[model samples]
Target: YKSGQKCVKVIVPENASIDVYGSGWVCNSGFKKSSTSCVPMTPQEIQKQKELEKALAAEIQRRRAQGVSGDDCETEYKTNAEVCVEITGGDLDCNESYGGDYYRDCDATLRYEVSTDYSGGAYLDVDVECSIEIEYKGRETYSTQTDSSSQDESHSLYAHGSDSETMNFNFSFSSYKEITSVKISSAQCEIDSVDLY
Candidate 1:
């Protein structure tokens, strides 16, 4: 029965009957009840909980120093090749019987160069593109037939094409951690080296 409630019913069993009403129960000598729950914590238990909290705080601080954040950095590579071939035929071919050696042939080597730069820890994405422009004897040639026999290829950060082509790419990372280094595969182009700021 509660402190202020009434016990309105009573029945005694033939075999056993025990009834205690209007009485308060006390806890053991060294135990105490708080609200509706029991709690027992020795000094060791309390010390262990404090130690766990301190270790958690230290781990969080370490992560912050490692530059964990919502920002990200990205990198990409691009390549291109421009080839020009100049063939000089010094005679108007009239007949094979014309005994005059007046034909000259000259060839110039083509060069391909690739360069890259990055913004340290500030890069959200990257874009790469390559273009080829052919100039013969100080004249711009827009015809693709001029270099039809030439073959070019690229093996970059994202391998795209061959034979003097343009490729565009974009990349994203998880955090704004500074870029450490960039590596390029062995290729047949002049690499100007990557720069980071």
Candidate 2:
């Protein structure tokens, strides 16, 4: 009897013995354990468990090599990575809205809206009033620079309509600027595979 079994009675088929008080249960040395019992793990099942553990370890190493943490695997992720594209310049001519606010930054005052449109589609339709600034060097910016010659301008951007019954849409800015991606988790609407520029 082993200590882990804690003095419990040993239960086994005739001529078979289970080590008592052990950290793990196993038949004593020289004892042949019978199969067909659902209480014990079969040899094939044990092998399968080892294989799964090995695969999971390999996956973790692979993710580490790619600089991806376990947290990044979430499909509908929230927080800093959840953000819309950058608003370079001009007004967005959005035809309709389904009630959503697209911000230029994660926590910035600059934002656009998706107007209400019950029309089903492959993409979520929304109206955007994008704002842009004219800088002294003629480059547009979202933030105000100290350059006295800089001026602000805004325009409306309208995306194409769709009836694909999926929350997907394509939008691009007037001026070329890098845009950060976003993930929106809505109780009423489910946005998927959206590409906003």
Best by TM-score: 2
**lDDT comparing candidate 2 with the true structure:** 0.28
Q: Please give, for residues 79-111, the per-residue lDDT of candidate 2 as tens digits.
A: 212212221111111111112222222211122
Tens-digit per-residue lDDT, 1-197, candidate 1:
33357644443323223322323222232222232222343477456545644664574466458864211222333222221111111101111111212111112222332322322342212222222222122113233221111333333321222122222112221122212221111112222232221
Cα displacement (Å) at residue 179, model 1: 48
Q: With candidate 1 superimposed using the best TM-score fit, by how many Å does residue 184's alpha carbon deviate from the native?
A: 44
The numbered model that scores best in lDDT is 2
Q: For candidate 1, report its TM-score.
A: 0.19
After TM-score superposition, what is the CA distance of residue 110 in candidate 1 from its true location, in Å? 62
TM-scores for all candidates: the values are 0.19, 0.21
How much is the lDDT of residue 142 in candidate 2? Answer: 53
Q: CA shift at 134, candidate 1, in angstroms?
A: 67
